[model samples]
Structures are given as C-alpha cells and as structure tokens.
Target: MKISIPFLGVLFLVTACSQPQKSSEAGDAESAQSKFAHSPLVEHIYTADPSAHVFEGKIYIYPSHDIETEVEEDDMGSHFDMKDYHVFSMEQPGGEVTDHGVALKLEDVPWASRQLWAPDAAEKDGKYYLYFPAKDKEDIFKIGVAISDRPEGPFTAEPEPIAGTFSMDPAVYQEGEDYFLLFGGIWGGQLQWYEDQKLVEGRKGPTDGIPADEEKALMPYIAKLDGSMTELAEQPKEILILDDEGNPITAGDNAKRFFEAAWMHKYGDKYYLSYSTGDTHFIAYAIGDSPYGPFTYQGNVLEPVEGWTNHHSIAEFEGKWYLFYHDTELSGVTPLRNIKMAELTHLPDGKIQTIQPVN
Candidate 1:
C-alpha cells in the first residue's frame, strides 16, 4: 500500500490530535476529572459506529472516522460527511487506547465517492480484512473490503467493491470455517430503496409514501462469504426478526424492529443478532439456534443516549463481555459523535439487561 507524502502529512496531524494531553492542559484536566464509564474512547478526534473485535490478544476497534463538516443535517444523514476510517486498539476494556492512523480513505477507494461509514474487521489465514460501507461513484451505498497485514491497519483497498452488495454497515460474523456478511440500514443508509435484491427506481421510505403500519419492517441481510472473504458466496437473504407470536416485526413497531447496524455473536449454543433501532435510539438483540436465523426478539441491550444515532458491537474478551457503542456526548451534535463501551451482562435465562447510558 503506497501512501503519498500529502497523506502522510495528514496522518501527522491526526497523530498529533490523538496524542495524550499533558496534565497542565486545562481542558484535558477538566475532561479527565469528569470522565465516566460512557466517556468517548478518544477525545482528540470524533469516531462512531464502533465495530470491535478481539484480534490476537488485544481488542481492536474499527469505527467510522467522524469529522466536522458544513453539510447540513437532515434525516438522510447528509451532515455525517465522513470520508475515512481509523482503527483503535487497547490492551483491555477501560484501558489506554492507541489510535492507529488512517486504515482506508475515500481517495484511495476506486469505486467509492464519499461517506465512509461504520466498518468491521476480521482475520483469516493471517490476513486482516476491513469491511466498510461507502457511497459509490453513482451515489449508491456499497460495501467494500480492504486488506492489511496487521489488525491495526494502514490497509490497501481492493480495486473495486464486493459485487452483489448494497446498503451500509457491513458486519462480518465468523462461525467455525464459515464467514457471513450481515448488513443493512434504512433511510439515509439506503436499505429502504432496495427490493427483491435490487434497487427499486423511484422508491420512497415509510415517511415519504410507504405506510409503516401495513408494511413488513425492512430487514438486515446476511450472506455467506467465500474463503477469500472478498465476495459473497451466494445471494444475500434477510435475517428475520420475529415477535412473540412468531410474526415478522412490522415497520410500525419501531420499538422492536431492526433499524440498522447488524452484529452477530454466539453465546453458548445460540446465535445473538443485535442492532440499533435507528430512530428509537436503542440497541436491541434477538437470539436463534443457528447463524442464519428467524431470531426471536429478546430485548434491548442499550437505551437512548445523548445523540440521535445508535450503533454497537458485542464481544466477549477474557471471560467478560462488553458492548461497544457510540453517542454524541463529546460534541453534542448529531453527526459529530464518539465511541464508547460498557461492561455487558447476560442473565441465566438468556435475557440481556437493558443498559442505560451514563449521563
């Protein structure tokens, strides 16, 4: 992966911003005093939509690198004009975090145009793969993969995005020898515009013309990845989230339906599928006996935070579980957000205790 000198200069600025502040710095002292469990993982630069994984012996976080922009805010998320990604790592939860400079950027992506969103990382055959969502040159969101020799990456993107992929928030879940891409988002994320595996022309979301109460809720998609992990092994399929009556969650049931940010993890013999209830501002989860699931809605894992958007990833490290999420506590602006993590607890009955974000 070749990086230009100009990009290296930008990395220098990013690194400077990521440096730990001296105690004499008043702002740093003040922030340190008030820091709590839900505080931003890194105060230097904004980050959100954290997709955390325990690679090797350390916890590495792959999150959207949020930047301040003049783009007007809207329900379509135009204000979130992020254009790159950065990887952060730590020895353990609540410990010091090291920001690994730019892993992938829009200028380096051949097929991407703008809006580099949430990303996830996976390791196979001694190589690390970073999966991210970005708007293609045609302005449609597509998932892409970048490769790195190490978990903390200055990754080189593939010449093109993975074919047969759309929408955003690509979360890769590995089980045994198989890897599956779990992805989708509504509204600005563009999941609503797709129908029958293709983008529907002149499509409108529920707020525009579609009746939420009568229509089945849009679902997140999952498809197996071939050994190379760059392309889908088969056509993507919807992972159903069902209500107690075994009915598919309806679009109107915003409190219990899938919104965006799909993450999968296995606990015991059950597969847990968790996601953000976009407008509802909750991190909810469902459980199934298999990876490809008709999961039964369990309950929320996180409550509303300071911001409008909610995204999260769950992983167990060193016999303890943690839920990595983001809120706008630092900037207090919807688009400029930060990532956070809290210890998560699962009960004996397989239910997750709803976590209320610290004020």
Candidate 2:
C-alpha cells in the first residue's frame, strides 16, 4: 500500500523494524565454545594449593584455607588455630556439595604447635591417610600424618611428624607394592617408606659422621614401604633424572629450578613429575620411564592465565584427566588464592598440552 504515513508512525516503524540477529548471536556462541573446548574448568574457591584424590567414587580436595586472622595480619604465620581443614563431597553427574568442617586441626594433633599447610590425602586398604605440613614452636615446617576410616575424617595423628626433613609439602603415592612419600621445599628433597623399622623403639647404629657436602647430597630419593610405616631400605638415594623422550635430563639451564614441591605420577609406561619453578610462578614437568631415575624437562605444562599462577596438580578422575591448581584473586601477587580444575587430554606425542582458562 503506497499510502503516506505520519511522522510518528514512521518513527514507530523504524524503531521496531531491524534485521534478524539470531544467526549472528548463535555463531558467536559456537565460536566461544570451540575455543574453550580445549581449556580447563573454572570455579570459585576458598582454598589454595589443592591436592586431590578420588576415593570410593568421589573426589576429595585437600587444600590450605586462608583463615581470616591470617588475612587480617597480612602474615603467613607459623601458628594458628584456624587451619580450616574441611571435606566436601560431589555426587555423580553435577550437583551442589556440602562442606564438613575442620577435618584436621592444630590442637587436634598432640605434637602440632604451629601452622598447618599443604595437605595431600589418599586411601589405601580402605583406610584414608592425610599427609600435611605443620610447624613446631621453632617455626620450622615439617610433614605429619593423620588417619581416619573415611575420607571425611575426624582423624587421629601419629606420635610425631610422619617423615619430615625440615621441609614442607608432603606427597604420597603407591607404586606397585610400595608406598613412596616424596616431599621437600627449596632446601632440597626427602623420600620416606611406610614399612620396616621400629619408629618408636630406638635403633643402635654407628656414630660415624658424614661430610657437609655428603649430607647435602642426600635428596630426591625413593624407597619401599612395608605394612609398618618404616623404611624397608637404607636412607633415600638421589636418582630421578630423565628426559621427556626417556633421555637423561643433563645439568644446565634446562635443569634450572628443579627443586620445590616435586610430585610424581605414573601413567602407563611413562612417569610424570610436576614441580613449581621457584619465584617464576610457573609449573614445569619432567618425564621418565621409572619412578626413580633421570626425568627430562617437558617444559612448563601450564602458566599464569589472566593474572593467575600455575602452581597446581594434574590428576585423573573417573577416566578423565583434570588439572587441579590455584590462582591469586587480588592483582599483583596476592596471597588470597583460589582453586581451579580443568580437563586435560594427552596428545599423540609425549608432551602434555598447556591448559587455558574457561569462561
């Protein structure tokens, strides 16, 4: 109809009429998901430096909580009452979860006189064992253990620090018939066995002493464990060194930043050892065929994405591999860290692909 229209009527038509934008919007969403498909899962968290393990069809995350008092003082003190050890359960598929408060606390353990941090938990023979680091009155970080019948625990502590070498960050793993505990800080490394000696009853040995350099050389060790939490062999020996292609990781710039929170994982015939590069805030990994040997640096597996640090763990859950790690919330090196989990897929080649953040 070629009828003349009033100015107001024309204005109304112009405001209401436009090209359909549905197709463009749909295209944008598809592009986003396609980009994010290779990325890690994102989440909000109250914990940091998380170590995860699945038990009885459920995943348990043991991390250090930022107590309010610790935040207020702006001091990562060596003593505190609010260690904030908690347990959470996630049901099959996806659903809301619940927090069971304070799985292990400082006062709960008889020998703990200070800060508790960096906890890792696992189950063996139907019993759950939590390995964590705490301080004595002297403020030195040492590793200890707690045991409970269930994953969510009101756990009981052993008589003393489980196996510590004036260090923190305890990681335990079961290799074949042996349970090996690998832990250390920048000072170096130590490995412990869960079998064979009388921990309570003293042992008579030679009073001979070793040189300072000889003592310092005693790190990056591996040993076998029996039913008892005692070393089945002599002191741990340094051996783990190998390349991503199963070659020896030689001493050089490629071998720089090889110390700190080193944890090993075995997948099929390859062994993956992940560790944090000190001060760089990046996570690097090495590969080996054996748990104890030369592991070649695979380079940084993951790094800070959008102002987040790459200090974390890559673990498998329900047949799917996931990277579970932490990041700072406040800008410029904030201590208030948050946990993140993302799915990890292995490439045809040996090296692991770096993970990206998901929306």
Candidate 3:
C-alpha cells in the first residue's frame, strides 16, 4: 500500500465546508454536526503531525513539512527525512488554508543535524514560539525552540537545543499563566534509548529481549516551561496512564498505550491527554484531574487512518472543536503525508466519541 510520487511544485488549496448548518429547531442534534468533508487542507505539498491552535481568532497550524526523499523506511523513522516546517492558517475550520512558506528549516538550525519532526506552537507576551523535535549533530532527538513575531513565521532558532530535552513530538499546553511541555516517542523516535535522564547505549525494546505482556508500557513526559518559555523549569516526569483498576497499561496493550504525539486539552474541570497508539495506528485519550496526571485510559478518539503513523491536535474554533491529523492519502506512502481535519465531539458523559476517517 506504500507508494511514492515525485514532488509537485504546484500549490492547490482544497476548501472545506466544515461549518455546521443552522436547523429550524432549537438546539437540533443534526445541526450540531459539522459538514466537513475529510480532505487534505493543502495538496500542493505534503505536511504531517499537525499542531493546531487558535491565536488572535484565527486557526494556525504548525506541521512537519514532508518532502520526497531517497532514505529507506525503517522502524526508527529513517524515511521521514523532513528538512523544514511551514505554517498554515485558516479563517475557520474547513475554510481556505493559506501556506506561509518556510517557517523554519533544518539548515538554519545550528545544532540540529537532520529530521525536523512534529512541532507545536504557543503565543506569549506578543511573541510566537515554535517548539520542534530534531536530531542534533550527535544524532539524538532533542526539542528546540524558534521565535517569531507572527503566527506564520520565518522563525529563528535558538543557539542550542533545550538542555534536558531528549525525544520527539513537542506539544505545549498553557493554562492561565502556566505552560507545560508534553513529549516523547519510542522506536524510530529513539525515546527508548534514554533512561535515567541519559542515553543508554544499545538499549532494546520488546522486539529485542523484553516481554511485551509483562513489561510496563513506556509513558510520555511533561515538564513545566519556565516563564521565558524557551526551556524546561523542572526535570521531566512520566505521565502515567492507568486502567480502570489503577494498574499501568502494559506494553502488550498496543491499542491503548502511548507511543508518541502527546497532546493535552481542557474541557470544563478535567484535563484530556491524547496520543498516538503508534503501531496500532489509533488516536486514544485519557482523562485526569490535572495537567500532570495519573490518567485513567478512556477510549480512542480516532480509528486507524491510511498510514502507519497517526499524529494529531485538538482545538476549539468558533465554539466547535476539531481534530487535525495526517494520513498518506495523497502519496499512498508512509512518510509523505498530508494534513486533514474532522469534527471532534465530547459526549455528555465527558468521553470523546470515536471518529472514523472518511474515505
């Protein structure tokens, strides 16, 4: 099912009709649904691992800019060989998307060697911050920060990667005046190589010698961001995900355990932590009382998509919530992915209704 195509230079915009139509009856259930047709927000180029946010009343997306490359695919994500990032924005969900060319590039990062992976963005004190994961000169994944005055940016990178960051998919969540960074990914993302805050050379996972059924699942991490918003204020801590009975979800439970792409959002009084079930290809979530959580596994937010990886972001726009994610629909290849969006609903009982990607 994996097929690659030559890069296309032409830029095409696919307008989405994602707005919910008004109904005659007050609070009609049918009217509450979005009419969004699941399709690539942009088709001229490939983009993935969408980190969407609503800034200044507009929907801004920070996604990994995917390009066709000669690198062979591997479990360590050797094939994703992305070199840059582009910022996209829309007036609203399912609207015309604007691609603000080349927000940041690999060549521009002084400390990074290769692979500009999934990124997230935040705004503070009239400045925009772009948080991204890239392999440094040592070939280990480290999170870095870029700054800009505009949401869509020609961002400038810091002189070095954040001191203690050691993994991929950097997602930033802010509540009131506090900002937290949630991150980590295993396998090709190389999160497994680090233990006890340092690299454990030649470490292996379940496929090596560890028994999946008995080994506790690897968990994503969260650290408070200092007021400057560029570095972690404290040491990273594991965000444990447990089952209904309070036991940690085991590594064998691929369908529910965290793999990568950590995201956090708040609804009413509860914090929702969602992530990709890497190999299983599901986007699942858990609910916790706080941002730093011992969350209880809830359920899947999205079913399997058209590729081996599923990365997503959730944001509220104009009183409705949407799930932004990526799939290989355009290239039919795993690494070359395109971003898409769908309506996400939180039911009356606080559980997310599972979303099925449209064909």
Instruction: Quickly count the clashes in candidate 1.
Output: 0
Error of 3 at 138 (Å): 1.4
Position 354, candidate 1: lDDT: 85
Question: TM-score of predicted model 3?
Answer: 0.89
Best by TM-score: 1
Which lDDT tens digits does candidate 1 get at residues 215-316? 778889999999898999999999999998899989899898888999999988889999998889889999998878999998899988877899999988
Using TM-score as the measure, name the better of candidate 2 and candidate 3.
Answer: 3
lDDT of 3: 0.84
How much lDDT does each candidate structure score?
A: 0.84, 0.56, 0.84
- Which of the two, 1 or 2, has more lDDT? 1
By TM-score, is 1 or 3 better?
1
What's the TM-score of each model vs. the native? 0.90, 0.70, 0.89
For each candidate, how many residue pairs have backbone atoms clashing (under 3 Å)? 0, 13, 2
What's the true lDDT of residue 67 in model 1? 82
